[model samples]
Target: MTTQELLDQIRHKRSFLCVGLDVDLRKIPGHLLEEEDPIFAFNKAIIDATHHVAVAYKPNIAFYEAYGIKGWEALRKTIDYLNKNHPDIFTIADAKRGDIGNTSAMYARAFFEDLGFDSVTVAPYMGKDSVEPFLEFEDKHTILLALTSNQGAFDFQTKDSEGRELYKRVLETSREWKNSKNLMYVAGATKAEYLTDIRKIIPDSFLLVPGVGAQGGSLEDVCKYGMTKDIGLLVNSARGIIYASNGKDFASAAREEAEKLQAGMNAIMRQNI
Candidate 1:
């Protein structure tokens, strides 16, 4: 989907919430295992329940990859279901992949062409060559990892290099790449304070933030510094929403959690208006 289309959905839904479909079989309700594909079954239920309030869904690739072929099949089914049933909802393959130019192009084809994801998360350690290949696909986004929420982020992302932080350099340097407008970024919600500087660097670029709820990131603080005139933020809540309940009411519980976040987003947007 185009960025404008995504922004339109956010406005219509009164939300910028990205529901993380990081499904863990062990954590899901035992009853779902009785189904043909437990992973897809759980995802379908959650998406059906929460699609109204959520503008995006991100399925972390590791979770499916761990299950091998069956996992991949489940992922395929999940994405296909979303495309057929709720194409308006943006889908993100949270596969933090980056490699040589040739290799990255294949990965891009896998997600953008074969799997049909709207975007994929990419690592920038290999520099411009690794990322530009993904950027070549028109209308498909390459979300680069910037300041992450994990504690290890301080070891490099915030450290000074010639008087500039590495994450800041990543943001500034990425803009010069070809088709950089197709780029979005991953900024951990746990480091909300850094968003002030991050916004100053790339105020218009969308950020896929994943650290709220389970990781203790404040929704208010993130928007206070990170929000743009277009509301360029996709705050994700995985465990906090999807695992809200592992009982028979799991989907309903998930919807309740999503509604809470969407309501919070609606209030924030109203303030901005």
Candidate 2:
């Protein structure tokens, strides 16, 4: 989806919520395992229950990859379901894929062409060449990992080199690549303080923010600094919403949790406008 289309959805839904489908067989209700494809079954119910409250859906690729071919089938079915039923909802293949230029291009085709995801999370450690191949696709987004919301982020992302943090330099240098306008950065909600400086660098680019809800990052703190005129944030909640309950009422409970976040996002959006 284009930036304008995404912003319009936020206005229409009064939400900037991105529900993360980080599904694990162990964590999901035991009853779902009775189904042929437990992962897709869980995802379908969650999507149906919370579609109105969420503007985006992100399925982390690792969850499916761990299950091998069967898991991949589930991922494809999930994406197909979303595309057929709710095409407007921005779909992300949360595959942190980055490699040599040729391989990167193939990964781009797999997600964007074959699976039909609107965006894919990419690792930028290999620099612009590795990431630019993903950007080559018109209107498709490459969400580069910037300041992540992990304990290990401090190890490399914050390392001082030439008096600037590594992530800061990554953000600055990414802008010089071709089709950078289609780029978004992954700024973890745990790194909310850095949003101020991040906004200074690329104020208009959208940010796919994880680390809220289960990760304990505050939604209010994220919007306080990360938000722009277009509502430049997609705050994700995986475990908090999807795993709200382990019983049969899981879908209902997930809706309730999503509603809570959507309501908060609506308030922030109102204040911004």
Candidate 3:
């Protein structure tokens, strides 16, 4: 999906919520395990329930990769279903993938062409060449990891390198790469204060913010500090929404949770206006 298409969805839905489909077998309803493909079953239900309230869905690649071949199959099925059923909604392969240029091109094709994800999260630690390959795919996005939600991010990301914070340098440098207009960034919701600085570097770029809800990041703080005139934020909630219930009502439960977040987003947008 292009940026304008995504922005239109957010406007129509009155939301910028990105549901994370980080499915885990043990946490889903036991009844779903009886299905032929339990992970996809869970994801389909969550997507169906929350689709109206959500503008995007991000499936963390690690979750499926851990389950091996079956996981890979389920991942493919999930993306295909989204593309076929709800093409307007942005789909992200939360792969966090980056490698040497040749290998990165293969990874890009795997997600952008084969699986048909609208975007994929990539690590910038490999520098410009590793990321520019993913950016080559037109209208498809490469969301580079800048400052993450984890505690360990400070070890390298915030340190002074060449008289600027490492992440600040990253945001500054990545903008100069090939097809940089296709770039969006992964900025953790927990680091809302840093967003002021982040915005100074890339004021108009969209940010995919995780670490809300279950991670205890304040949604209000994120919007207050990070929101741009274009409402350039995709705040994600995974375990807090999908794992809201483990019974037959799980779908409805997820919907309710998503609705609550969407309502919050709506109110925030209104306040901004």
Candidate 4:
């Protein structure tokens, strides 16, 4: 989806909530396991319940890849369902893929053309060539990993090189790449303070922020530091929302959790206006 279209959805829904569909068979309701496609069934239920409150859904590729072919099929079905029913909602393939130019092109096509995701997460360590291929797709976004929520991120991302931190350089350098206007960033909500600096570098860019809820990132803090005039933030809650219950009430429970977050975002947006 185009950025303006996404922003319009946020306004219509009164939310910037991005529900993470990082499903784990071990954690889902046992009753779902009896279904033909357990994963897609679980996802469909959640989407149906929460789509009104959420503007986006991100499916972490690792969760599906671990289950192999069946897992991939489930993912495809989930995206197809979304496109067929809720095309206005942004879809993200949290694959974190980056490689040589040709390989990156293939990865881009796999997500953008084949699976039909509106965006995909990409690692930036491989530099311009690795990411440019993904950015080349018009109206599709490439969310590059910047300041991640993981503890190990500090080991390299915040390290000083010359006078600036590595991630700061990543933000600065990426803006100059071809089709850079398509770039968004992954700024972990756990590192909300870092967002103040991040926004200084890319004031208008949308940030795909994870690490809220279960990861202990404060939604209020993220809004304080990360929000832009366009409400440029997609705050994600994975386990906290999806795994809210492991019983038959899973989808209803997930919707309740999502509604809470969306309400919070709605309040923030109201105050901003």
For candidate 3, the C-alpha RMSD (Å) to the true structure equals: 0.9
lDDT of 4: 0.96
Clashing pairs in 3: none
- Tens-place lDDT per residue, model 4, 1-273, is 899999999999999999999999999999999999999999999999999999999999999999999999999999999999999999999999999999999999999999999999999999999999999999999999999999999999998756899899999999999999999999999999999999999999999999999889999999999999999999999999999999999999999999999999999999995
lDDT, candidate 2, at 197: 95
Estimated TM-score for each candidate: 0.99, 0.99, 0.99, 0.99
In the range 32-107, model 1's lDDT, one tens digit per residue, is: 9999999999999999999999999999999999999999999999999999999998999999999999999999
Displacement of the residue 153 alpha carbon in candidate 2, Å: 0.7
Model 3 Cα shift for residue 87 (angstroms): 0.4
Displacement of the residue 54 alpha carbon in candidate 4, Å: 0.5
Off by over 4 Å in 2: none
Model 2, 10-75: lDDT tens digits are 899999999999999999999999999999999999999999999999999999999999999999
lDDT minimum window of 10 residues, candidate 1: 156-165
Poorest stretch of ten by lDDT in candidate 3: 159-168
Sort the candidates on lDDT, descending order.
Answer: 1, 4, 3, 2
